[model samples]
Target: MRYARFTGLISVLVANAIPGTALGQSVRIVPDLTTNSIVVFQGVDETAHFYYVPLEMDFVRAADGKPRLGVQYFKEGDGDSWRVAVSTSIKPAASDSELAALKAKLPKDNNVTLSPLVLDFASSYVRFSEAKKPTIFSLESGTLSAGSSIAMKFEFTGTHDAVLQALAASGPEVGVMAIITPDASLVQGEELVFSGAAVADLFEKEKFLLLNSFDESNAVVAFIINGNHSAEAAARSWLKSKLGSPEIGKDDKGVWRYGWDLTRPELLADLRSSPKISLPTFSNVEPPNKALLLPFGNICKDYPDNIVNLETGTAGCN
Candidate 1:
C-alpha cells in the first residue's frame, strides 16, 4: 500500500510531456515577480535557451509524489541531448563566526556539490507498457472512422531499439501526440474530452482534448536555447555550462549577454526539413507561482483543447 501511494505520488511530479501541446512552439511561460512582460527577442538566426529555477522552499514532487527540487531545459533545434538540473542548498558565512560554522551547516551529501547540469530522465516502462512501430498516413479531413482515425497511421521515426520494438507490437499503446491550435473564436479553457490506448484515444472526440493517459502531465513548459556559430557560440558557451539554472553569481553578478546566430543554414536545415519540430532542451523554468504557474489551469480545464491565452489579445481572427 505504501508502494502504491508512492507510485501515485511519482505520477504527479515527474513532469512528463506529450509532444502534442508543444515542445518548441507552444509551451507555457510563467514569469517571476522580478518579471513584468517577457521580451521575446524575435528574429531568426540566434538560438533559444530556457532555464528551470527552483526555490529551496518550494518542493516539486515526483509523479509518485516524492518531494524534490528540480527543473528541465529545452534547447531549440534538432538535437537529442540537452541538460537535466538540480540545485544544492546554499550556506552563507558573512562573518568570521558564521564562517566557522559553515562546514557544519553545509549539506553532508556530496550530491549537493556544485556542478554543471546533469541528465534527468523519465522511465519508459512506467509510461509505456510495450513496443509498436508507428505507421504514418494522411487524413481526408472528413468523417473520421474507427480503424480509420488519422492518428494510427504515422511513421514513428527513431533508431532507438526500444522505440523500434514498441512500434511493431499489437494491442493498445500510445505514440507521439498531434496538437492543433483551434480557431481563436472558441472560448478559453475548453478541451476535448478524449482518451485511448493509443492514438485512437483522440480519434473521434468532437470536444476539447485532454492529456492522454499515456501522457504524464496535462501541461508542459519547455525552454529551448541554441547558438548558430562559433562566435555567438563562444559568447554563449557559458550558457551551455549553466543550462538548468544558474546561481545569481553571489560575487560578480551580470545578465551575461550571449546569443547564437539564428540564420545558420547548416544548423537548422536538418530540422526544417522534417514536418515535426524537435526540441532538444526542456527545463522546468520558473515555478507555477500561483499567478503564472497555474494561470491556465482553470482555463485549461475549460479549454482542454486550446493552446491560446484569451486575455492577452482581442479576438477577431475568425
Candidate 2:
C-alpha cells in the first residue's frame, strides 16, 4: 500500500493506453546525445503540446558488456516542490551470490528491485479527473538481460494543465528509457552532426567567441559562455547585437538561460550568410539550428542590474 496514502480523496477509473492507437495521444522518443539520454514524451494528436512523465532511465554498457540501467523517479511535493523519490541502478544478476549482494546494497523495502514491479498510479493519477480508482498499472521489468524488453503501463490523466505546471516547476527529466536498445532505429526527425572544425573556424574568423560547445545531438548544439559577470554582460550584448533579442528564461535551478531556435527559414538564411559556418544539408528535412547561452554560476534574480536585453542592448533588470 505504498501508494495508498493519498487514495481517500476521489475515485476515478482510467487505464494507461498507448498513444495514437484509438486513443487521441501519441508517444515520441527523442534522443539527446548531449546528456546521453532518451526522453519519452506523451503528446496529443500531432499538436505542439506534450508532457514528459516523471520516470526516466539511462542505459549504458559496462566494461563486462552487461547492460546497466539507471532509473530515477520524481515525486511532486507541497507548493511547487518536487523531489527525487527513487534513484537506483538495476543490472542482471549472473549468480545467486551476485543477486544477494545487489539486494543487500539496495534500499530495504524498495519495490523497484522486485521482479515485475507494479507502479500503481494511486497518488500520481488521483489529480486527474479522468482517472479511475483501483487502477492496475504495472511496469514489468522481467529480467535485466540484454535483448529483453521492459513494458511500462501508465496513463496521463488531468487536462495537461497539471502536467504542464508540474513540468514547468520541476523541469524536464533528461534520460533515456531502458526498453529501447542503443542501436534502435532512428525515430522521427532528421539527425544533424555539427562540425567541430567549422565551429572552430567561425571563432577563428571572429564570428563569435566560442568559449565551449556541446553537440547535443546531430541537430542541436549548446554553447557555454564565460562565467564572470562582466564577461557575461559583454557576451549578452554581443549576441543581442548579432542575433537580435534572444528568448530569456530561468531553468529550474534558477540559472538564467538564453535560447534561440533557428529552425525558421529566415533565421537559417541569416545565420548562413553572416556566420559563414558549414550547415547540414538534407534532401527531405530542413536542417536544425539552435543556440543556448549559459553563464556558469550565475543564478537568476541575483544579478538584476547586470541583466540586459540582447535586442535593445538596454541595461535592464530582469
Listed per model in order, the count of residue pairs whose N, CA or C atoms clash below 3 Å is 67, 8
Regions more than 4 Å wrong, model 2: 1-24, 29-49, 53-318
Residue-wise C-alpha lDDT for candidate 2, range 136-249, written one tens digit per residue: 222333322332333332333222334333222222211112331211111232222333334344433432222232122112222312122222333344344445545655
Candidate 2 yields a Cα-based lDDT of 0.28
For residues 59-156, write the lDDT of model 1, one tens digit per residue.
22348643332122222246443221222111100233432343244346543221111112111111134443433333222221111112122223
TM-score for predicted model 1 compared with the true structure: 0.12
TM-score of each: 0.12, 0.15
